[model samples]
Target chain A: MFFNISRYLGRFKLVGCVVRNFLILLVGLVFSVNALANPNLGLPPLNIPADNPQTAEKIALGKRLFNDKHFSADGTISCASCHQEDKAFTDGLPVAVGINGQAGTRNTPTLINAAFFETLFLDGRASSLEAQVLGPMLNPIEHGLQDQQVIVDLIRQDRSYTEAFRKAFAIKVDEINISHVTKAIASFERTLISGDSLFDRHLFGRDHTALSSSAERGLTIFKNKGNCVTCHEISWNNALFTDNRFYNIGVGFKQLTPVLDKFIAFVRQGNNPDYFPLTAVQRSELGRFNVTKNLADIGKFKTPTLRNIALTAPYMHDGSMKTLEEVIDHYDIGGDQNRFIDSKIFPLHLTTQEKQDLVAFMQALTSSKSPNHPTGE
Target chain B: MFFNISRYLGRFKLVGCVVRNFLILLVGLVFSVNALANPNLGLPPLNIPADNPQTAEKIALGKRLFNDKHFSADGTISCASCHQEDKAFTDGLPVAVGINGQAGTRNTPTLINAAFFETLFLDGRASSLEAQVLGPMLNPIEHGLQDQQVIVDLIRQDRSYTEAFRKAFAIKVDEINISHVTKAIASFERTLISGDSLFDRHLFGRDHTALSSSAERGLTIFKNKGNCVTCHEISWNNALFTDNRFYNIGVGFKQLTPVLDKFIAFVRQGNNPDYFPLTAVQRSELGRFNVTKNLADIGKFKTPTLRNIALTAPYMHDGSMKTLEEVIDHYDIGGDQNRFIDSKIFPLHLTTQEKQDLVAFMQALTSSKSPNHPTGE
Candidate 1:
């Protein structure tokens, strides 16, 4: 009887253990799948905004809106007109040309990794991608739309768009708004993550032969003598190739020097509508000062990522330089010496071979994964 | 002869146009691919830190380190002991039990979607995951390592770990440091992104059948009468269900109120070694004030994400409540009501059915994707 009772007790104990383990296993199974990440770029997962999550339908809608020229005043140009996918989302022009052949002040910056940026535009004006899309859409010199209502009305007119909006956002046809339009565009832009470069393979993938000897030497120079790493940073694990900070590298400072005080005084007095939509020549030189209106921020522009630097031509906020060689030469001479020049800017005294190597290294930084425009047919 | 010359000119123009189009097509082809995202959770891409990019090898290494019990002083427990994968990376205990059943001050918070957080821990002391992992490793009641060097030494002693480190980081055996261990663990932790909840499907995925009618009504109460939306925010596009701010709901305030003045005065003195490793009872009551050392911040705790709330039970910073019904009841009565209670904690006066619906809605938030423990064999 004692033996029978002990066996029953043992069976009960076994049952308890089994149930406990099963519960744990069940819990583990409930939270199992891994999220997506860009390991090739050594990039962490993208920090998607809580308000505007990505959906296949929304991304498709955004691409349509981005390429649609109807949003423009004369229906002559679109966002794709300036941010062409061919030249790493840049127009490859010295300055952006809008409808009617009208040129904008600043160069059209690459939208390659704009999703990772803290602030948008060269001057660091807009804070979010959602906020940044509206600036160009409503800018008098760009898309030239009068107000946000016009964008909403234009989107509302299209039957296909209304259906697409309904599918993506689950909102009624009448409820379609400007924020919805920008949200779609921003979602599409976030998908433009460029990684899997030759450089990434050499470093992250542990492939020694991925980079050429010249490029390897250039990488050393970039981190050391060139001092380019101060602005175009490459972290120990990943390389965004940008510190995301503003600096006056003395580009376009020459033209602004004479009229500096007057511009500063005018900007200090808020609500100066006349100061805005400045002539292309004057706007090019205002740099970050245009956004912050701070005298200290004058001539300072955001450090552009060097990730597909080889494809983008006419570098700098003004798109002054035509080639990488010209940019290096400018840096070699400690930039165009101006009072607001960044402290890190100094004469590098690099040799011809070193300069060529630097260019080679930058060329290797181009991603193997190109940004595809999924028409979403 | 004039007609022939005109035809030749037309042919030349056609050839030029073809060449231009081909070049544009080639550029477009060179930059064409999309990055990854977590839309099911209404989450943007994860904002990976540049210094600790994710790698499969590194994530594997981190999993090994996280599960290894040898790092602890007594070799009885590991990080996994408390942050079990089954319970949404949390221990269901009222407060964390460390080496030799040493109870900690605060509850074991869930590691699910920790990668989305700006500040870590209930007190919001640690800034980065890399930095936060070190706290438990060295804490007397937790992993109980003497210093960072001990962790480095422990890993070095393991030949398999040394080999894995070489593969993951491309560093020599001797170069293995505590930072690398933390980086690997943090990378693994970042992958624990819990989304695809029924709530996400109903809202972001446009699946009307995802939630019951009662749960749907609960969502309305959560947003309107409950005033939960003021803190547990759900944006139009996505829902993190948290504003990522701190507030006091008076959970452990009763135990803290009498000795609050004494504790505040002692904390203000600063640099008091005796004050540290406060008894679990005392520690649980400090809340946000422990980190900020400010009177205004006393008894406040971070607003936890409700993404996987159904799985992580015994709610709040102290883990006082045992069920969803109890949690709703506490909120309905405007929480425990203390001197430091948040103004938003006014009486909700929710009906019994409304309370049940809220619980039902929360249960619907259980993510379909569970946090898997990839052993990396």
Candidate 2:
């Protein structure tokens, strides 16, 4: 009887061990599933507007609108026209030509990773991408649309669009308005995020080989000798490459004659026709002043991200400097000192080798591959 | 004697089992280390150019040059002046303003992620980024440099620059030429890559939350309803968002009168002195045809990538379209019908909901975070 009892006890111990091991394995699997399903992916979630919480249907609708070219008067250009896919969503030009072939007074900024930007436009006029979306539709130089009714008419004409609207929102087709357009476009724009640069790999993933030694050294110079970090600022998490601030780097310092003064004054009051009579030439010269009434904002422009600087050329707010060397020269001199120049403008006194090092580092910022979306079709 | 022998045998067996367990542990450690060091982590290795292999010293030198603005004629512009890091290395403007405040015809392109481009410039004039570096330096409308010797002189005058050259190239300071400048700038450009987009996570990494359902639907529309992927092919591996081709979408149709045609023909045949006489207006009208004498290539502009379309607004080659909606409207009509319009130009009868869906998809392309680079003090 004692021998039988001993055998049974041993068997019971063996079964207990097996059960514990199985339970541990199950727990591990559950934990892994939870980890895989983590929605944030270790990234900070975006602060979407209250009215436009990110939804699958809304994003889909916005994307369709983004690629559809039916919003213009002539139906010949789409959002993708100026903002193409390969050129970081920029048209790759010195200036943007609009609906009637009318040229505007600014370069197209890259939208590759623009969702992080605090303000929009070269002059920091629009506070958000959604707010800025409506500015161009109303501009005579762009799509040349007369009013909101034209967009509504175009939408009402299509059944598929009506169905898509029904699926995205409960509102009827006739109820669709400018706010809806902006919301959808904003939703789409918020999704364009670019990360995983060589620098990011080096810093975040601890991949030393991601950046060459020279590039690493250049990064040091960019932070130190080049003094680029003063304004550009590398964050611990993300690097949008802009301070989200405005400054005048002395691009508009041609002697302000009577005509120029009047133009400047008019632009300072904003682009509103009620406050000022702006000529075509004057309108072109209206930089930051057009957005803000402050004189200090004259020639002051919004800081852009440096994510894909090598591809976009004819540098500057006016697209004047052609080569990177010329651009470096301008900054080396602190932007042709003028009365309106920002106080931050000061001689960098960067050595030629240091300049080259900075350039090398910037090149390292370029990616070896482009991002492509999977086509369900 | 029998008992002693049995005890010795049992001890020997115990020692043997201990040794076996130790060996197994050692093997497991080696395997774990190897797994941790695995180089291929889902993504392919970066492609470095054979002509421009990455090196520590070279990148350092390039960074130095990138920050040095003395390379310009007036010593007022640096590569950083227009391509400020804070501004994503772009001066906020519809058109670039160059030396002596001369305004350029197009908007400044961002240098971010530019190394992947097969050809440089909006018109695809320069075949390589390296070749493009010098075009702007010598262009009368840009940096306005007299010749390459000026750059060499500027370098020779700086002691720090000379020392850096010796360390980077093992050559004398005087040996620095335009080629060296271009190479450095190009090397730096190569580093300006943008990876880690939300779409990348959604597709490649199998992160389901990377894209909203609306964005996913918009992606479908971008491929099917919008027919955008026809020209803007999204790669399987990298989503560059561009096919890198040229097309004429009727940008300067009104400007292309019979007189304009004769003048363009004169310029292309190198006989403009008698017919067009190089007037400012005539010179400005010579778009892509001036670069490639192919008549079929007239008015053809390079297709841009749409990675970050929302941030860089005032769309098109002329900065005319103020909003994405206007851009969509223009494309709905397949561009103004003209003599040299692209065959792909056709009216896309999209619904209002579809337009909104498209815009939402575009917003989804925006990055939630920005890049982090060292800022200048």
Candidate 3:
């Protein structure tokens, strides 16, 4: 009997060695295949969190959950309400609209390259994509959920979601929570990487003929004369086209000027989460100041990514400018002059053709697979 | 006899090992001590070329050579004529007045942080500081030397210079040449590092009380609204304040626009070093295009450092704007409109107070020891 037990143990040890080797190979294979090279966009790699590894099942569940209206206070709204896939994940609105036709103060920024952003939102409040999902879901003007439990309860009750949670997270039905939901949604959002553009082909691929001659000239103006490359960065290897820092380019500074003192006093008041409701206009105008409350940050808003900028219209933090030309014109005049305006916004004495060329160059930034990927582009 | 020879050789080998170890220790010690930290300026180590290392004797010799007027055709115009120490190493002239009062087309840029420049000169023609010394020395309108042989012959004849050269370079008097002269001058120029600005203290040293509240607000404008940080870069670790790239900010573009086609044709004719004499204005206006012959590079001039900007009067390539206010106004108006003007140049509608704040902030950038360092403040 002792001899038999010893032989069985030896067999088990051999099986264990084989299993360990297989796992090592599998990990190596996964890493080698998935080092985040989105060749189409010339992107480096997606920063996937360790805790929430992307599974096909998780991504599918996230996509379904992203579209599910049951997560909202009213059945009419979901995450997709404002971020429609057709408009490069934007609703093509000046500001986001919520349940019962409630309106948001700020313009809807596109989610094309949100994964690469250091901080989310025009005000740059959220530090991560996972955290940003909760902002709109709870905001009275957006998804309008009462609290975290509402989302968790909804997931637990749904049979499909329960199954999805089990498959994605290896959790029981009771374990379905807001954190898992956010993780899944963020995971889905991460896959929305788009890089293949005419400009990308011309620049990174060294396909000189990819860009139009006018676009090429426009690029020079954009880089040199326009000084746009300062805020919209393009490194030697990659071009996120955003410095990801805040600046007040004089968009809506005029309205805030008259009541600047009053607004400052209001924001200086002790921590109030519900400040957005009472001071929607003030909050929108305050921009980054609403977050940091630093005097230097007054009227500052995060520089949005110029990737797929053409599809998302009604530009600026307030959605004040309509066309790209108008936006250019505003910048040409060096933004509205205010005490707090960023000094960099000087008048660019660009001629009409040069302006058109700048527009052309920006147009070239549109990804070939964007404005609803795999369907609309 | 064999025993004696082997014993002697063994003794020599033991001495050689001690000598080699000592040499290694010496090199390691030199590197640790001279790793290029200028605490006052918070600058990184100066990039000393491997071929021409910095020595105290070499720097002193270069300083003497920098002030020596005999190098000019008429013993009046040394490097100091254009780059005067009292004027923050700038002539404080709208344009450089060369030998016999011949006016060059561009303003004399500051040499405060010039050692950090990737390329030398306003047009960025010179590849290195060593190469740059020849341009002004040989320029018929500037120092007006007939050839390199004249300077070499003059240096050989001078008793003090010959001895200084010997001490600095460890070369025989007969071995002295233009390259040695330039190397010495370049080495001296490299030591003109400045970082002890009030702004530097505040930004880099974490000394919040260093900057005035007005200057602090102005910094915000300079960073955000002015967008000047685009060309004048400030990294997290260091602030070179120059992107080292060229742009056409519409400074001399107006003069180039009418004659741009003719100018292109003239530059396209072929390599002509003497082109500067005949087409002085055209050469200056052509900017970076003269160096590369690339059509896109027209009207582009290297972004000069803003360090000690307050000391250097008559800003811009042409030096048309006399004061900081005038320079601000020119930028405010978007730099006199032109087809090739950098699109980044937009009308900055700065309030009078804001403009003053910007000036104050720039003034804060002046190193505490600048404007004739170790002498004037």
Question: Largest TM-score belongs to which candidate?
Answer: 3
> Could you tell me how far off, in angstroms, the CA of residue B16 lies in candidate 2 after the best superposition?
99
Q: What is residue A93's positional error in candidate 1, in angstroms? A: 0.3
Candidate 1 CAPRI category: incorrect
Rank order by lDDT, top first?
Answer: 3, 1, 2
What is the TM-score of each candidate's chain B when compared with the real chain B?
0.85, 0.80, 0.85
lDDT of 1 by residue, A1-377 (tens): 63454555556688856655666676566643211123346554577999999999999999999999999998988999999897889999999988778888788998987888889998888989999998988888888989989989977888999999999999988999988999999999998888767788787666688799999888877755576765686654567888777888889888877776676667667656345545568766767767766566678899999987877888988888999999999998889987677545667789999999999888888876655312111
Show the lowest summed lDDT stretch of 10 residues, model 3 chain A.
Answer: A32-41
Q: How well is each residue in A195-261 modelled by candidate 2, as lDDT tens digits? A: 5556666654456786777778878766544546535646444455676776666665553333556
CA RMSD for every model?
31.6, 37.0, 24.8
Candidate order by DockQ, decreasing, is: 3, 1, 2
Q: For candidate 2, lDDT tens digit of each residue in B1-377?
A: 63454455556688855655666677778875653333221223456667777777777888777777677778766666666655455666666676888877766666665676767887878887778787767767677889978887888888987887777677887677667777777787766655445555665445688677877776766755465654555543455566667777666555565565665556568763344555453444455666766455556677776655665565666666777788777877668777666545556777887777777777655433324222110
Q: Model 2: how far is A245 from its true place, Å?
A: 0.5
Q: Give Cα distance to truth, residue B47, candidate 1, Å.
A: 32
- Tens digit of lDDT per residue, candidate 3, span A1-377? 63454555556788856665666687788864543233455554568888888889899998998898887788778888888877888888888898879998988888887888899999999988888989988988888889989999988888888998899999999777789988999998887778877788787776788789999998887766687887886654467888788988888888777777665565567545335343567657878877886656778999998887888887888888888999999989888988677656778878999999999888888887774433234
After TM-score superposition, the amount by which residue A139's alpha carbon in candidate 1 deviates from its true location, in angstroms, is: 1.2
lDDT of 2: 0.65
Query: Judged by lDDT relative to the true structure, which candidate is superior, 2 or 3?
Result: 3
